[model samples]
Each structure stands twice: as structure tokens, then as C-alpha cells.
Target chain A: MIPVEYMSVILMIVFGFVGMARKFPRELGATVAYTAMLFALAVFGERLGRIVYGLLYRGNPEAAPDLALVQWFVILAFIGAWVVMVYAGQTLSFAGKWPPNAVTGLVFDMLIGLFNGWIVVWTAWQYTHRLGYPQQALGWFVPPLSERASRWVALAPLELIPDGQEPWVLGGFLAFLVFLRVVR
Target chain B: MILSLQHELNKLAFAVLRPVLGGPNPAITPPTGASTGAGVGIDGQVVATAIPMLGADLSAATLVLVGLAAAIGFVRGVRREAITLMVAAAASLIVGWMWPAVASLVNRLWRMFHFAVIERGILAENPMAAWGEAQASAPLLPLGGDAAAWQIGFFVFGLLILGYGATRYVAAPPPKARGIRGFSVLLERVVGAMVGALTGILVSRFVLPRLVPNAQVALLGPGTSLYDRLAPYAPTTILGIVLLLILFGVTGIGGGKPRQKMYQ
Candidate 1:
């Protein structure tokens, strides 16, 4: 069986190549949606998680949400966003101008797709840790992460972004993206 | 001898530019009453260390380089600059992350080469001591100082390959593109310049220093260039710039003639 770390990395690579195959316009829509979702998670994921547990799980003050439930919740959320953006006829689209030409454009498409994949994997990391690594019990992740995976965790987006300004920085970037979109 | 000639050239360039970058201006005289930062003085810090041919701070040169980079970016426009952004970010990030692995790979190859050719082939009669003798005879160049040279070789080779690959994907902009108006054209240059400056900094300040240790000490070491402060936080900076570039893309910054479907 492949280690969880190796599996997730392969998944990311697959998403990148898939994006390359889809080309840029559809990929761009997917990217914007993914990044917007990441921004939402960064800002309100914790509060929303609590709201779900309280409203649906009897609000039992002492009992935490099930790890499987949380994992499924995060997974479903990303899948929902991907569907809405990539397939729902609302993706950011531009066939010709921006990527300049074909070979480089495909590379750019792959990179953006890779970025989205990273966001997905990174979100899983945050949710798992926020609820205390529920995957450890299910044999998805073992105690004492391998050294390479540990390095990967160390480079987690906000964790690596210094000065505790992750939310502000992320929000500002999203706003700018939206502004440019609106202007054009 | 070639290295010495290169050193002489560095000295000659420094001597010519010293009055401009290092020496005080002869144009304006300071009044006697002026404090003039007299205690530290202009030459005090430099003279103390006494390293000639490299005393210039490079702050002025950095600005000029940045300006040149901005001009290059302006010409490239938004699409090309955006593409270059990813390439630059990849180059810097890869250089930062892969050095140890590359160095290790080189070491293993060297060991295999030494065993196969040097030990068994050339000096088979006394193979045991031959490798040791070769290592000891010359401490530089082919003997073993190739470590630093190897690092440079890897850098140049990687850069050339990546650059050559990029050219296939990127081409010159057509002389005039239809349907592009004032704001879009202006925006292209503006964004292009911004992207260009960032890529320039990524290459020169972030990438080059890490690749070449000797240049790092001479140029970006503590108190060497103002860009040194940002170099240490390169990963974080690259992450931010990557996000920003994506944010800038996916919009109407690109306006041009229709594109043909590629690889058909």
C-alpha cells in the first residue's frame, strides 16, 4: 500500500496533468474557485466547523465532531466547489490571449492546477489537525510523520507565511483577483 | 591565469566606477558646520575591511538593473511576463530545494567514476594508493576543487536548459494586435513591468546568491546589498508572488489576435 503522503502527492500531480489536458480557461475558473474556497476556509473554517457540530451533532459541549465526518465534510466541500466552477458553466474563460502560446500555456495550466491540488491537500491537513489528526486512528496516517512529510507540513501555506498575517494577505489577494475580473 | 585576468577586469571596472558609486561627489561641497555623518565617514566601513575591487555597495547598480528589467518586461507584455513569472519562481524554488540532492548525486557519480576509471583503469598496478595520490597531488581543479566548479556547472546547465525550453513556448508579440484599446495596452505594460521587476529580483537577488556562494558573500552578504534582507525569506516571498501572479492572470490583461489550436 502506498503511504498516505505519497498518495496525496501523486494526487496533486494527477490534478496538474488533468488541468493541462483541460487547457487554461476552464482551469482558470477552477483555480479562482479553489482559491476563493481556500480564502473562505482560512477566514471562517473553524467557526463553521463548530456551527456544524453544534447544530447537527446535538451541541453536546463535550463531544467533538467525528473525524470521519470532518474529513468527509472537507472533501465534499472542495468537490462541490470544483463542480460548481469547472462544470457549472461559470468558469473564468480566455482561450487565446493570456498564456501567450501553447507549450508554455500548458505548463501554466498545469501549475495552476497544481496550486489547486496543493490547496486541497493543505486544507485536509488543517482540518485533520484542527480536530486532532483523526486519520491516525483509521491507519491513514501514522504517528510520527516521515521526515519528508514533516518537511511538507512545515511548509504549509499559513504556517510558513510569517507574521501571522495569513488571513489578511489571502483576503487582499482574493479581492484583487475579483477586482481585475470585474474590471475586465 | 584566466581567473587572474578576470579579477583584473573586476578591479578595473571598480576603479572606473568608484567615484560614482563609492566616492563622495565633487559637484557639491558640504558646509563645514554640517555634521556630514563624520564619525562613520564614507570610507570608514569599507577601509576597515579593506577588500578591494568589491567595495561598491551595488545599491545603485541594483536600481539600474531593476529599471532595465522593467523595460524588458514592458516589451514582453502581460502574457509573456506572466509565463516568465512561473518559470522564475520555479527556478528559484528548485534551486533552493534541490541543491543538497544534486550535490549528493554528483558525489555518488564522482565516487563511481573514480573507482572505475581512475583506480582500476589508469593506475591498475597500484590502485589502492593511486586515488589517494591523485587527491593529494593537486588540491584545486581536477584534483578536487571541482566541488565549487561543479555547483556552477549545474547552475549554468539548468538555467540554459530551462531558458531554451521557455523560448519554444514564448514568441515575439505581433507588431499590432486588433481590438486592444488604451487601458488594456497600458495595463499590459504596467503588469509586465511589475512582473519583470519581480522576476529580476527572483533571479539576481534570490536565485544567484544561493547558487553561487562566493557571489553571495561578495554581493548579498550582511550589509552588502539592501536586497539581502529579503533573500533570507525567499520561500515566503516566492509563495506570495506566485499567488499574486495567478491573481493578476485569468482576466482580460491579454488582448490580441485570435490563437490557433495547438498540437493539433
Candidate 2:
């Protein structure tokens, strides 16, 4: 199999180009906003899912659907939130008084896009490699699930510079590219 | 100061990372052996547990608040005000760094002053008894706790100052007056940079330390001494300023003339 880390790097590079081509700070801003939202979901999503399950089932664990169903709901919610945030960001960027100018906005979008793209890839890698699935992965905050989940997601795929540092390298390169574009 | 900062950072890190690292679990679950309490989880095991009421996990709440703030800042075009805000933020970090000593000194002075008054008053014959009585009575000042509280208070105060400064600068009358416009813009930039710097420092001190614990000591420097911690953040402060300058230099920092298209 192609190294997962390499796959992430390739994903980041491709995303970087997409970001540059979009060339709107709002697009970058939207990505950041989405990332933040995703982070919130990752931290709280599972709990929310359980709460919904509890309220619906009313203390009857058997009344709830299988674990996979709950996991799918959480995953779908995450995707929904991402879509909403991106759309909201795009709308606000046009409606609001940010980015000041087109060129600056484009640069801002490009840089943020690069950073965000890396974050997505990293999170995905963590999901596939660390946690078996999105629900179990994000549910790691809870002790019971974490104990069970650790067996599957504990080991990181071996990489050249540790999976954590990939974004910085990718972002820095993207920033350099923007700087060159501006100065040139 | 370092210890307190570390404590706060640990809390923040656990809040942010636990969910990401650990799988789905209840926000606050009682320890395996305990009926109720606060505790720290290490590697999937609860290591320390305390009063259940105090054990409420605030990480999710904090994350939400931070996310809101970040969204607002980005939406408000706060980056446009980066230069001035960075400077202010840097200054705030230095103040936060020195706050422990300042708080200690103030505490000493207050105690001495209180004792002096007690000694000279009607309770002069039994000062210790009078001090005890005073302790029993409601405090004259509502202030409570140690340097950590004061440090947090100062951090909030700095944010308020920055917020107010930014609002005033942005709301200033257009440069219709002779030389006033140029001066106003200059002041706005300064204030904006200061706000950005203060926000940066707050993030560094509270959020960054936990997210990147290893980078924390490096950013704050070696040793527990205030100078050591304060000196390292200076680069972060300087970098904020430099970033603002570069941002403006390239973007041409809005030359006072209104653009024809608002969303270009």
C-alpha cells in the first residue's frame, strides 16, 4: 500500500493548488471556519450523538440502533456542519467588509486553504490509522470508548517527519509561493 | 506564573486533544471506583478523581467559546488591524509575565496596610483578635484568591482595552481635517497591531502552551523565572509586528480612498 503519510502529503499539495486557484480569502476563511467547526464536532459530536440516543431511547439502550447507525449519524452531521460553514463563509465574505482587496483576499484564501487542506488530510489519516471510524475516533475523549478504541487507533503510520509536522511544512511552502507571487 | 500557566494549558490541551485522541465517551463520567468526583485520565485510565461537582469537564465549553471568538475575529476583518493589535498583545504578554510579581507586591502592601489600620484602631489592644474578627466579617473588597486570578483578570482587562481601542480607531472621523486623516490612520494601525499582539500573547500563554507543550518552554524559554518566560515570547511579539508590516506592505494598507467595488 502507498504510505498513508505520503498519501496525505499528496492530498495537501493537490488541495494547495485548489486553494490557489480559488484565490478568495473568504474561501480560506471558510476552510478555517469549517476546521474550527469540525474540531468542535470531534470533541463534542459523540456526546451529542449519545445524548440524542438517550433522549430518544429513554434509558432503554436496546431501543437505540446499532453502533454503526450512531456512527453514521455523527459522521453525517459532521459533513453537514462542514457544508454549512463553508457556504456561510462564502456568503459572509461577499457580504462583509473583509479581505479589503481582491489580491490580498486571494493570498489569504490560498494560505488558509493550504493550512486547512493539510488539517483535513491529517484528521483523515488519524481516523483511518488511529481510530477505526469517525465515531470511535472522536469518541476517544470518553474513557470507556477510548479504552476499546485504543487497540485499533493506537499506532501512527511511520512517516519521515512525524505526522504532526506535515502541515507546517506544507503551509510554509504555500506561504512562500504566495510571497513569490506577490513580489513577482 | 509558569506553573499556573502550565496548569491552564494542561486543561486546555486535555480538552482539545482528549476528544480527538480518545474515542466516544460521556462528557463527564464518574470514575470506575467512585460515585462522584473530578479526575485526570492518563492513557485511558482515570488517575485522579475528586468532588463530582468540581469534576465537570469544561473542555468542550471552552472549545466552543474559542471557536466563536475565532469566527468573530475572522469575520470582522481583524487581520486588517493586525499591526497595532500585535503590539498591544505583546505588551499584554509582558504584563502577564510580570503579573505574578506585581500581584505579590500588591498583596504584601495590602496586608501591611490592613494590619497598620488594625493596629492603630480600637482593636489596638488585641490586634490578633481584631484580625480574626475581621476575617469573620464580610471582606471589604470582593477580590479572592492569588496571582492566577489577577493574571486572568489582567488578561481580560487587556482584551477589553484592545477591543475599545480598536472600536475607537475604526470609528474615528474621516481625515477631513488638515493632517488629521493621516494621523488617524496611523493611530488606527498602531492600535490594531496592539490588539492583535495582545490576542496572540493570550493564545500563546493559554492555548498554545497546552496544544504544543514542548514548544511552550521553548517559546517561554528555560527556567521558571519570569524573565526567562517573558524573554522568549518577545520573538512571538516581534513576529506579530513583522507580519503586520509585511501584510500592509504588500496589500498597500487601504490608502484612505474608498474602493468602487466593495466585494472585489
Candidate 3:
């Protein structure tokens, strides 16, 4: 039987092609933007839910609902808030007479595409090795130069932070960059 | 050569930006005695070691690059695009953070199916027993339990939010021009092939060696000629190249302009 590890390597290549075929940078940017918006929504929704729940219960544990029920309520709140925020952001971003709209879209799209492509390759790398394939069965497929290139690619972000520091430091810096990019 | 460049860059950066960002410190290193195997460093507590100067240098270089890119975008009046790129970067960070939980959930679900099949006499006898043995051998999360349930719930919720948000906000913008521009088509093919080849090598060298160390897939095995070492990578590299070519062919081409109906 063809080894599963080999199959996974094939799958990774297919994913890479699909990513490029789909216009890697654009799709990648969109994925990242959407994911970030979703995360923001989730965080906002959870906070809102907590506030609402607190008001309803008035800090009384005895009056609180079951754990599952509370969890469900929180999830619902998260979804509701996320939907509202996404729509509002979209409308705001597109409605303006912004000259940079097209350019911004293109640049971001390209950046995301590159990032996503790397992610696809990285995840595939992890899987083929971790999933119990015989040594070198899948590893032999990757070229030497590519391996070095991937490491460098991976290191770009890793180099930004002091070792052992929270990743958010970099995230915050990037956010600042976005703000600068948008404000002008 | 790259390392030296990085070192010089870091020195310059630290001298200039230390007042604002902070003084340069050593980069974090893995605990000295920890094995480089799966589940070795998952726990939050990693014994600290002297940070690599190279890491610091790289960090400085990255900062400079980001600043340069932002400056160029500002000059080009692509403010919106720069903003979008920033947002995308932030979003990537969020996704990266959540990926582990999501992957763990998927693995558990797959294991459940595997277990069920084994129980049904598909693979072996005493499937649960075999599973227990496997679980003990691999340093993975539990297949199913309370923690698993919570993880599944979180994954489902996250997916739902992402799906809804994507449909509403992340729809692909309409293409402006039609048919593949010749230059762009060529560019795509060349870049795609290069990227594909690199990815093939990365998969085999860095990722596989770390995860499946026992597998005899070292890129530069002791005494092996470079040609022999690279022989196995040929198929994967070709596959990558071909896939990229197809991708470029299909997506690079655009529909013709309304006035010109020649290439329909």
C-alpha cells in the first residue's frame, strides 16, 4: 500500500498549487482578515455575554443556570456580536472615497497569500513526520535548498521578538503598522 | 555571510531603537537537556538558556523590513492596502494561536473513527487495547473525555464564526482585467516552480526529521553524494512544479474586456 505519509506530501503539494492557483496573496490576506475579525468578534462577544450574565445573576451563583446552558448562551452571544461587527466593518471599509482601497486590497492580499502558503507547507511538514511514516519515506521528497529557504522564511517572524517573549508584542507592533497604514 | 549581515543590522538597530523599544537581550533558547521530540516542550515551563545573538539580529532586521514596507506603502498612497495587510497579519497571529486546539480536536475525531473501525474487525483484534498502547506510546492528548468535549465545542464555535464572517466580509473582489497578462503569466509560473521546489525540500528536511527522526530521510546523510541525496526529491519537486503550472494557467487568465471579444 502507498504510505499515508507519501499521500500527505502529495496533498501538501496540491494545497500549495491550489493556494497559488487561487491567487495566493489575495486569498491568504482574506483568510487572515476574516480570521482576525472573527477572533475580535469572539472576544467582544464573550465580554458582552459576561456583562449581561453578571447583570442578570447579580453575582448570585444560586440563581445561575447550568454550565452547559451558560456555555451555549455565551456562544450565541459571540455569534450575534461577530455578525454585527463584520457587517459594520465591511460597510465602513468599502463606503469611503478611499483612494488606497484597491491598492490596499492588493498588497494585503499578496502578503496573506505568502503567509498562507508558508503555513500550508509548514503544517504539511508537521503532519507527514508526526503521523508515523517510516523515516525518510516522506522527508526524501523535499529538496535541500528548499529546506534552508523554509527555515529562513520561518525565522522572519521568529526574529522579531526576544526569545521567550509573548508573541503579542509582535502582534501589537503589526497592529500599529496597520493603524499607520490606514490613518494616512 | 547572512549571519554577519544580520549581526551588523541588529547592532545598528539596537543602537538606534533601544531608547524606544528597550535594550537588547539574549534570545530565548530551549532547555539544555530537553529532547527534541514531540511533546517535549509543550508545557509552558521551558528552562531558559542564553539567547542566540543571531535571533536578536534577525529580529532587528525584521523590524527594519516592516518599517521600510510601511514607508513605501505610505509613499505610494496605498494606505488602505497597508492597513489591510496589517489586519491580515494580526488575523494570522490569532489563527496561529488557535490552530493547536483545532488540530487537536481533529486528531481526536480521526482517532475515534479509527477505533470504531478496529473494533469492527477491520484492522486487528482488541482495538481499544491497541489504542491504549498507542496512546501510551505517543505523547498526544486524550482521544475523548471532558477536555475533548470542550475542545470540540470551541472548535465548532470558532468555525461557525469564521464561516459566517468569510461569506459576509471575505468574498473575493471581482477581477478588473480579463485574460492572462503575458508577463504575469510567466511570472506566476517561474515563482510557482521555485516555491514548489522549496516547499518539497522543506517538507523532507526540517519537518520530517524533527517529527519522524527514526525515518532514514536525512537530506545530507553521512557520506552520501549530493546527487544521490537529491534523487528521492525529484518526484515531489516535479509534482509541485506541475501543480503550480496548472494553477497559473487556470487562474492567471481573465475574461476578455467587453469591447474585445477575441479570446473568448
Candidate 4:
């Protein structure tokens, strides 16, 4: 009932804009409009999430027990992706051209978008399934000897998550690629 | 962020309203920067929505009227036109603050006396019901209250960004470099003020309603509110140079002259 998949639909639009922005930065007035829309969308998503949770669980998930963990991961994941998508999409759109030629550019953009979408969905699923449990303790979940611990704990994988706005920079790069393609 | 935003809003209110109160109009010369006014009515709505909010408070209201009066004062600065500005500002302040309720009442009266005319139009069958429904669908946020404050914050942030941008890309040497004379300077200022006023009217009447329809809900005539304001809003044929100078290009109209003496 929460319609967790709603996030996917939003991503689709974000990527769609990225694809379009590559070809039409000035015409679309997209660089700013898209960013503004994404910001507005984030607020809307939170409100929608609350509404969905209220309808599904008959109570606000933010205030409920055993649901807080799910809420945290789900909400954070959505926010993280939401921000990243804008940065990524904008980069791709603004660049407005493809490498070497149009065919190569379009193909490369589609491939990157596809992969980005996959990674986002996969990470979301992991969070939804494993981290979704409300009572699951954080640090103890992975044993010291276990593979999860060695990679996630010992390697400290979360550190690899780039700092704020880095993804947006990447998004700008992607936009440039699109711009090159469309402008040519 | 909130404090800076609020301060900038206050400053802009001062800049914009200084004209209305019979003050010298320190006109905003538009620059020929990229015309980004294509369809997205953000700027239009931002400026249009600002008026009602400014009118909500006495000081802020005075600032907007003063800004307008400043614009009207043209080459003459605020010092020369104090009396005219005060009367104009006071009148506009009263009108702006009271107009919403007054307009609402008038609209209600029009509906009553002109019921036949109202019904004969597109919504002839159930005009009142449709009007009620439209009112019901108004934005959840209150007009000219907290939402307006948030909007003002955003507007301030935008202006800051725009100001920084202007400093970077749009600043140009004064018209002295272009070799214009006394008559040309006067013409430029007059034309610029007229252009800005026209832009204000067109934006207030059209483009603004579309981008932030709900924000300008109180302004639209009844027939106008039936749909999105964005769809119909279009840029006026403001002269290219004036528009450019207003947004980004600076002509230094007030440059290097002895400040005119205040009216004795």
C-alpha cells in the first residue's frame, strides 16, 4: 500500500528530463527548471510517502514503532537517489553532445542511464529487504568474520559514497554529453 | 539562510516600493542577458507575488510603493519628490492592503447583479457552483502569509544569485562609453521606466498566473482563473536594449553627476 515503487516513476521522469535537456538546454530553460522541479518533487515525495504510509498501515510511519528503521532507510535512499539523479541528469543534459558522433553519444547515455537506474533500484531493494526490519540492530547485524562485515565494515564501504554535490557534478557531466549530441 | 533571505526580501521590498511613494524611482535597468523567460514563469510569479506580501505589512508596503515612486521619479532621485511620493505611497498602500477583500466583495456583487451574464458564458449552467469549486481548489497554503514568507526567501536567494551573475557577466561600461548625450540619456530613462511598468503589468496579468497560479490567485479576474496562468503568459515587446539593460546591462544613468539638490 505504501507504493514504494513510486520512487521509480519519479526517477523515470528525472532521467527523461536529462535525456531531453541534453538536446534543449536553452529552449527548455531546463537547467534551472529541472533542478527546481526536482527539489519540489523531493518535498512532494515525502508528503506522498507519509500519505501512503498512513493509508497502508493505518498510522503515520514516522510516529510508529518497528517502522522507523524502514522509514529511515527508505526515506534516505529516496532522498539520496533524488539528489543524485538531478546532478546526474543535469550534467548529461547540459553537455548536449555525444562523443565523436550522435550515435555513440545516444548509445552511451542510454547505457549509463540504464546502469544508474539498475544500481539505484538494486540498492533500494537491498535496503527494503534487509534493512527494512525495524528491530534489526545496526552494527551487530554483520558478524566480524562474515563477508558482509569484511567488505562493508572492514573496508568501510559507506565512505566510498561521494560527498555532497559530487553526484550532481557527475550529472552535469552527463548533461554535457547530451548537449553535445543534440547541438551537433 | 532564513535571516539572510529575510534581509534580502526586506531590501528588495525597499528597492521595489521606493518608487510608489512619490520618491525618486531608482529604476532597474534590464540587461540583454539571455532571455530565459520562455514559458517558465518563475521570475514573473516571484515579482508579482511579492507585491501582496509587501502590502501585508506597513513598512514593507511603504518600501514597495517607494520603489515604484522611485521608478516613476525617473531621473529625479527620491529627495526631489518627497511629497508626491508620500501621498502616492499612502494611497497605493491602502489600496493594496484592502484590494483583496474589496475585490472579493466586488466579485461577489458582480456575480449577484450580473448572474445572467455570468451564466450565459461558458459556465452558464452552474456558475456559482463552478466558482465555488474553483475557490475550493485553491492552493492549500494561505496567500501572503507563511507561504509568502517562504516564497520571499526563495525570491531573495534567486535575486542574490542573479546579482552575482550580473556582476560576473552583465556589467558594462556606462553609456558615456557609447557616446550618448543629454537627450538620449533622458530618453533611455523614460523608455526604461515605461518598459518596466509594461513588463510588470503583462507579467502580473498573465505570465505570473501560470507559473505560480495560486500565488496570484487573488489578482486574477474571475474568467482568468478558470485555468493555468502559465499557458497564456507571454513576454511583451519591451525594447531589446532597455530589457537587456534592466536585467543585466548597466548604463550608469545616475553616474558622475553632482547629486541634484533636494527640493527647497
TM-scores for every candidate against the unseen true structure: 0.50, 0.31, 0.24, 0.20
Any runs in candidate 3 off by more than 4 Å, and if so which? Answer: A1-49, A59-63, A67-184, B1-198, B201-264
User: Over 4 Å off in model 4, which ranges?
Assistant: A1-63, A70-92, A95-103, A122-158, A162-184, B1-264
Q: Write the per-residue lDDT of candidate 2 for residues A94-123, one digit (tens) a residue.
A: 222344545334444455555556555555
Per-residue error for B201 in candidate 2, Å, reads 9.3
* Descending-lDDT candidate ranking: 1, 2, 3, 4
Top of the candidates by TM-score: 1
Instruction: Give the distance in Å from residue A137's predicted Cα in candidate 1 to where it truly belongs.
Output: 1.0
Q: In model 2 chain B, which range of ten residues has the least summed lDDT?
A: B213-222
Label model 3 with its docking quality class.
incorrect
- For model 3, the chain A TM-score is 0.32
lDDT of 1 by residue, A1-184 (tens): 5655776688789778877876665566566676677667666666665566567657564676574566556555655565555545656754446455553466567877787777666666656555566666666666665766655655455555555576776777667666655655
lDDT score, residue A35, model 3? 42
DockQ of each: 0.16, 0.02, 0.06, 0.01
TM-score of candidate 2's chain B against its reference?
Answer: 0.39
TM-score comparison, 1 vs 3, better candidate? 1
| Model 2 CA deviation exceeding 4 Å by range | A1-184, B1-30, B38-59, B71-76, B79-99, B108-148, B162-249, B253-264
User: Residue-wise lDDT of candidate 2 within B167-254, one digit each (tens)?
Assistant: 4354332223223455445533453434443444445454333333323222222232434556545534544553453343334334
lDDT of 2 at A35: 42
Considering lDDT, which of the candidate structures 1 and 3 is the better prediction for this target? 1
lDDT of 4 by residue, A69-112 (tens): 54645455564766456554544222222221232233223333
Two-chain DockQ for model 1: 0.16
Fnat across every predicted model, in order: 0.26, 0.02, 0.13, 0.00
